[model samples]
Every structure is written in C-alpha cells, then in structure tokens.
Target chain A: MTRIINRQPAPLGRLVLATLPFILLALVYLLASDARLAENPSDKLLPSMQSFVEAINRMAFEPSRRTGEYLLWVDTWASIKRLFTGVGISAAIALLIGVANGMIPYARAPLSPLVRALSLVPPMAILPILFIVFGLGELSKVMLIIIGITPIMIRDLQLRTDALPEEQLIKAQTLGANSWQLILRVVLPQLLPRLIEAVRLTLGSAWLFLIAAEAIASTEGLGYRIFLVRRYLSMDVILPYVLWITLLAFITDYLLQLLSKKAYPWYHAQLGEK
Target chain B: MSEIPSIQPIIEARQLWKEYGEQVVLERINLKVMPGEFVSIVGASGCGKTTFLNLLLGTQQATRGELLLDGQALDPEPSPERGIVFQKYSVFPHMTALENVMLADEFAQSALFGRVWGSARKALGKKAMAMLERVGLGHAASRYPSELSGGMQQRLAIAQALMKQPRILLLDEPFGALDPGIRKDMHGLIQQLWQEQQLTIFMITHDLQEGFKLGSRLWVFDKVRHDPQQPERFGAQVTFDLPLASEGAKQAAAEQLQQVSNPTTISKEQQHDLSNAV
Candidate 1:
C-alpha cells in the first residue's frame, strides 16, 4: 500500500483540525445540558453554558462580597505559585543528583536503587504521614508534589544522562573538562530540554497530588473550591473551575514546549516532528 | 630547521597486559610512537584494538605493566593531552559546529558557565571559525551534528578534536562509517591536518587499505598462542610493527595481500611460530 501525507499543514487546516474535536465535545455538553434542564429546570448536574459563563464571570471578573477580591484570580496565583515552587525545586534537585549519579558510577551504584524503590511507594499513601509531619499548611501540600514527582523526575533525567553518548563525555574531558566542568557545560545544556520534557510528563501526577492534598484540606485552591462547591451541588461553578484548571495546564505545557524549542533549537530539529 | 630533534618517543607502552582474572585481553604489548608520526593499528574484530586504544586513552587500566605519555606515567583518566575521534557520535550532538569547536576554549576560560565575554569570545570565535573553515565546515558552523551528513559529522569531529591542540590525536576508525568517496576526502583532510598541525596520531582501523593509506607506521594486533586447551592463556599482542618511513610500505603491502588471501592466516602463522618456540 502507498500513502501520501503532508508534513506541514496550512494554518487554517491545522486550526480546524485542532478545534473540531473540542467543538463536537462542546456540542455534546450543550445538548446534554439542554435535555437535563428541559426535564428539571433546577438540575445542578448539567448546567447550561449561560450559567457556566455567569459563574466564571462572577468568580473571575467581579470581586467577592466577602473577600473584596477576585477568588478565581487569587486561586490561580496561589495554586500556580505553590505548584511552580515545588516543581522548580524538584527539577533542580533532579538535575543535581541525576547528572552526578549518571556521570559518576560510584554515585549511581548506591543511589539509583534507593531512588527507584522510593518512587514506587505511592505518594498519596504517604499524604497523611506528610500532613502529620508538616501540618495542614502550604508545607505539606508542596511536600506532596515534591516527594510524589521528584524521584520519577530524577529517574527520568538520570536515564537521559546515562543515555548520553560516552563519546561526548570523553570528548569533553579531552577538551580539558574535569568532572565538574563536564557536567556543567556538556551534560547540563543537553539535559535542560530533557528536564523540560520530564517536568512536562510529571505535571499530570504533580497536579493530581496537588489536587488530592488541596481537597483533603486547604483554605483556597482550585481543588478546594471544586470540593467546597460540591457540597452545595454548584455544578455551574465546578464545571467552569474544572475547565479553567484544564486551560491553565494546557497553557503551561504549551509554554514549556515553546521554551524547549526556543532555548534548544538543536533538540527540536532532531526530534523530526515539531 | 629546529635542530632536527632526534626521534623522541612521545608515547611508550611497556609489556602492557590487560586482563580480568579469568580472561586475558591484551598481553605483553610494547610499542613507542614518535611525535608527528601517524601510526595505524590494524586487527580483526575481538582482537583488543579498542582495548589498546582505551589503555592509551587512560579509560582502561592495564592489569600489569605501564604506559607513559611524554616520558611521564600516563594517568588512567582522559585529559587534554590526548584528543580522539571515533567512527561516529564524536561531536556533541546538542551543540552547533562552532560551539563544539570552541568548547575547549570556553572551558579553559570559565569552567562553570562557558560564557566568554568581550574580545575574548570574539577571538575564540574567530579561531574556531578558522578551524571549521580548515576542515571545510565553514558554512556549517551553526548546524547541529545530527543535521550534518556522515562525512560532515566526521569533519566536525576532527575539528572539535583539534580544538585542544593535544600532543597526540587518536582516531578509532574515524572514517569507517562514511562512503568511499567521503572516506577518500577525509583521508586527504586528515593527512593535510597531520602535516599542518605537526600532530602525532594513533589510529585504530580494521581496513587494510585505509590503514596503509593514512598512517606512516602500522601495528597488527592478534592472538598468537592460541592453545585450545587453555584458550584464555594469552591475549592479543602486536604481531607486526612496520615503520612506514623506511621500507615499511612493502611490509604493509605484503600484510594487505596476505589479509585478502586469508584473514586468519597471520594469526595462525604467529600462533604456529610461538608454539614452535615454546
């Protein structure tokens, strides 16, 4: 059999292709909401798009009556701050240990097994332990993301570092790089794009851990709001909040992909599929 | 003329035997390579060619005996004193050709960030560009190694290796992966660089023609004392060391012809001779 495929699609074609699925999904939701509302005008399980828009506008655009501030925006800031802080620290630690352990055999021999074993222990299972240890503050929540995601990130990066050509390492050494210089110059630059990819992969689990912690106990977050409004059957607010979270995650992933391509053009070029 | 410095051996390996407790890999390998001499080591697969190369590169420690670079005992770690070009995957794939060439200069100035500022960066860039142009990669300075063709990648590898101005350059079948046309071009480039740089080179190659064409000295590695009863008793050794400067071409031609006729005959001959002597 023969095949014909275009590697580069036109912008309009791409745009259509990207939005077609979303458009269909929106249609399904709208139809489902209409049927539910026709049966029961006050059904909270399937709220109309008007209600969704109104709920989001009230939460995002208008100041809350109690707090005198936009709750949605506030939640965005707080949640993102916590998420990025934990992820940033995790990436740094993963890079440090991953490069060292990957490049040096002695470091790898003992540490790799421990990292692999710990990554297996479910982070949610340790959530209560972390809460007890760190208390019901930002510390515990952030600790969840770190402990849940860092070991896997470290392992991901360590494997990348290990897969690095021995020729490159030897070449750097021959160019007068000591171990420190080798890691810093040759290995680190190469690892950055991979680190971005690793972070991207762990973002889902990171968010899962974050939401789990927030749902269990937290004053304010996307998860806290969704679970809070769940008691009152506020489907309008919950649905909108869920969509907003999805949007934020999408934007983050896009930005990271953009960063990797921009900062490391060589990597993108080699990937063969933008 | 700089007083025509009498032949000084830049690299010396004395009875360098490498082995595990149960297996002997290389045994009693003795050789001296002079400065500015292109020496080629030829052998069949599994004949300790890479092992000998690694021993010289300091990646592998000989189980016994010693290796000296410039009359000093060579430390068993890779250093700037020796540069190497492999068959493939030599250049840093993540960097542009120019960046790859300037890596050593950057490390020399600042080991941490590799940020050369002001006129220094300009100077290094110029030097690196010159090397790239010398290797016929002037237009490919910004291309990644993956983007370059196999021949171009080999050229980039050579350029990167020459960045440090090492005393000796090691090439482990650098052109084996290239097409014949490109290999011929690479041969010219290597010979030209060797002449211009006054470089001492130790190249490991399995191809007899390529070994004869690029190098001035030839060393053949093979297992000589192959006793089926005690197969691991003796490892590969330098069976023939022919200096191309003097009547060496004839010896290389003989070995090449012999290789073509029967690849295993040399090893068998050496084994028979060793057994008779024993």
Candidate 2:
C-alpha cells in the first residue's frame, strides 16, 4: 500500500529569510520618515494627526447628513449597508446572466460578439444613457455596476465552460447524461474554481464601479461620501473612506477565496503545490 | 463459469459501418458480446476500435449498420444501459471519487424519484463506496481525481463507469495510461467486476498483452489492398475480423501484440498492413 504524504512545509527560518528584503525596505522607510518627523515637530504634525483621528472617529460614530447647516458624519454601518446591497444585487444579476449565457451555445455564439463589443465600451461612456433611461437613482448606479462587471463575468464563464476537458464531456455523454445534466453535474462542477476566481475579479471590478457610480448623483454609499469630501478638498475624510473600501475589498476577496478552497479542495491542493 | 450459460449477449452490432468525411473507419463490422464476456478489440492506431466502442455505447451513429441491445435496436438517445470508461482522466476533477460514482448512480435512478425518496441518494452513496472498496480505493473515496495518482484516477474512472449497473460496459483503453504493474492489477479488478456483475464488456486496447490477458476473443483488423503487387497501391482499406484459431494463431497473435506494444518492432507484414489500412 502506498501512502502519499504532503510535501514538507518550508522551515520558519527560511520563511523569515525570504521576507528579509521587504522587511529591510520598510525599516529604511520608517527610519527616514521618523528622522524628518523628529526634526520638524513644530510643522503642525500634532494638529494633522488630531484631524486624522477626528475623521476616523466621525466616520465610525456619526451618520452622514444630506442637507446644509447640519454637520454630517458618515458612519461605518451605513457604509457597510450600502456596499452590501450594491455589490450583492450587482453580483447576483451578473452571475445569473453570465452562467445562463455560458450554458447555451446559440446564445453564447450570437451574443459573444455583442458582449465583446460591449465590454470594450467603457461604463462611463453609457452613463448619460443610463441616467436618461433610469434617471439618477439607485437603479442607475446598480445598472452601472452590472454593466461594468457583466462582460468580465460572462467572458470568464465562457472560457471556463469551453476549457472543460473533452474526455469528461464524452464520458458524461456515454453515461446517459442529457445536456442539462451534463451542464449542471459535470460542466458546472468543473467550472466552480474558475467561477470563484471570477467572483473575486468581479468583486474588485464592482468596487471600482461602485465609486464611480456613487460619484454620479448618488446620495448613499462610501463612494458618495468620498466624492462629497473631495469637493471640499478634505483629504482626511476621503482617506478614511478609501481605506475602508480597500479593507472591505480585501476582506471580500479573502472570503471568496476561502469559500473556493472549501468548495473545491483539489484546486487548493494543486495551487498549494505550485 | 457455470453461470455463463445463464448469461445472454447484451450487445449486438450488426454490419456496423462508421465513416468520417471521405474516410470509412469500420465497415460492415458485426459483433455479439455475451453477458459477462470480456471481449477485447485489438488493432493498430486508427483502426476505429474506439469508434466501435462509441457505437456500442450509443454515443456515436453507425453510418450504415444497426446496433442492437438485448435484441432491440439501440436508441440514438443516451441511456444508462451502457457505461463507458475512457483512456484519459474522465472523472470530474472537482468531484471526489465517491461523488463521481454516486453521480452516475443518481443519473441512473433519476426516474425513480417518487418511489425512492432520499433512499436512492443514500443507496447511491453506499454503492459508490462499495465500488471504491472493490477497486481498492475505499480509503481514497473522499479524494478528488486530481489528488489521486494516474493509476488511482483511472481506477476511479472505472468505478464511476460501473456504478450505474449498466447492462453493457464499454472500455476504450481503460488501462492504456497505466504502468505494466498497475495495468495488470486493473485488469484483475476489471475481470473481477465483470464476473461479479455479469457485465458485458467491450474493451479496446492497443496493448496486445492486455488483449491476451483480458479478451475472451481478440478482434484484429488487417489492411487490404486492391493491388498487392502495385508499387503504390491506391485503393486500400481495413478488413477487420476476429483472429482465426489455427496452429500458428497463438504465435502470430503474440507477434502482432509485440509489434503493438513496441512500435520499433514494426515488422514488414505489419508495415504492409499499416500502409494498406489508410
């Protein structure tokens, strides 16, 4: 009986050694910046730090205000709620349309050229059209996000579906699988890994589009807050929102990858080997 | 082998003709495989052995012949009556070994949903597990195909094909990718499965030794030319049939098998046949 053990993990010492260059660069940067800060302590550094802290505190605690003379502060909960609703609806629609298009060859073949053409058209190019059709409401914003992300999702699904191993398809056909069965059972399972990857890519693209969508006639969302602060040249307020969005993207991408590994362990093992 | 008498031919191909474009692969090929019979089709590459298996499995259409299953003409539609295992990795890579086999069983019982309830799914899991055990892969049942070694993956493929309780099993070079030792083991497993399930198997192999070891009857295709003496014979085609049982049959079979196993052994007769096979 042959037992295959996993390859040994790299030693901790060697792992630390591998990070030496990045660690050294960070140390150099910290030392150089620290010297400048120490030499010019009277350059209103305390007030700048105080302002940064106040912006974080404000975004975390106080909710945003829409009208004038009412000091508005964006809260974390509102930002999260807007992100969840916007990304959730956009991803769901994109995934459904992408998967449906991928499964039907007739649809994919005729629609692929149109999709390719549409993908080339920037989301911003059709903002005016969307604004006129759906108005400057949440529908337009969500539609913009869908437009930005759908092409990528469709292309990914199409490529993954096409890249399925010929032998597996033949085997499924020989096993009495109909087209639907083949797609759901054999093809979809094989597409799971790529679909997860697509989700990550789409998530990032959705976030990118979210900011733009929010900047355009949007009342809610981190994007709107960032845009509003940008008008005032209040970099402090904008910086926190940027950091929050970055953190949110990182967390969502990480969660998606984690789910992918759990759902398709073989993908993780193969990737881990590489 | 007393149970053999109770078994009947499950797969019958009558005058099967398969052509692709201008090239005819199998012409007027007739074969009857009895239940529990381990029939191996041995030929050089491009002799249409795989095509014959496809026809039997109903995955392909015969150009001008009829294929019958248990006295009925095989439906062009796919059915659970025939299961096929391929030479390459056909097991769904995203699925575990058990899942792969279970999926086949589920597909087979898709119509019995009202009567079976969730029992069918449970039974499928149990059956898949039993199949894994039979193939000596019970411990690796949870492992995905890509996680398994090449030989193990092929074994999983075999299990998946057989899990459907198919009346006839079609194997196209099932062990063609395995090493000699693993191939021998897989052959033993296949033979055991055939006996246990009373399965009618039509296996295609380029390996002469595999044909000898597993095939109850070996079908060989010899190339024929209209003008044998012509320096460049133009009208050439394959004439395939079961090898004749003669005094020199065993020796000739071994020689041909050797040529197939080792291409460098390319004897003059084999080369002549190969040239005419085109």
Assign candidate 1 its CAPRI class: medium
- Model 2, residue pairs in steric clash: none
**How does residue B61 of candidate 2 score in lDDT?**
89
lDDT (tens digit, per residue) of candidate 1 on B1-278: 13434475789889899998988999998888878899988888888989989988889898999898877898779988899999877888788899899989999998667658889989999999999999999999988887899999999999988998888899999988889899999999999999999999999986666676677887888888898998888899988787666444645445444553335634555434323322
Q: Which number leads on lDDT?
A: 1
Clashes of each: 0, 0
Error of 2 at A148 (Å): 1.1
lDDT (tens digit, per residue) of candidate 2 on B1-278: 22334455667777777777666667766677666667767766665667777777667788887888877888785567778788875788777888887776566567332112477667778878988998899999888777898789888888888766777788888887888788878888888887778777778877655666676666765444334465232211234343423425545655554455334233456544433432
Residue-level lDDT of model 1, residues A1-274, one tens digit each, is 4445647668999999999999999999889999999999999899998898899899999999998889998888878888998899999999988987898899999999999999999999999999999999999999999999999999999999989888888888889987888888788989999999999999988888888989998988888888999999999999888888999999999999999999988888777732
- Give the true-contact fraction for every prediction, in order: 0.78, 0.53
Q: What is the TM-score of each candidate against the true structure?
A: 0.89, 0.78
Q: What is the C-alpha lDDT of each candidate?
A: 0.86, 0.69
lDDT of 2 by residue, A63-92 (tens): 535333222233344445555675666556
Best by DockQ: 1
Candidate 1 reaches a DockQ of 0.60
Clashes of 2: 0
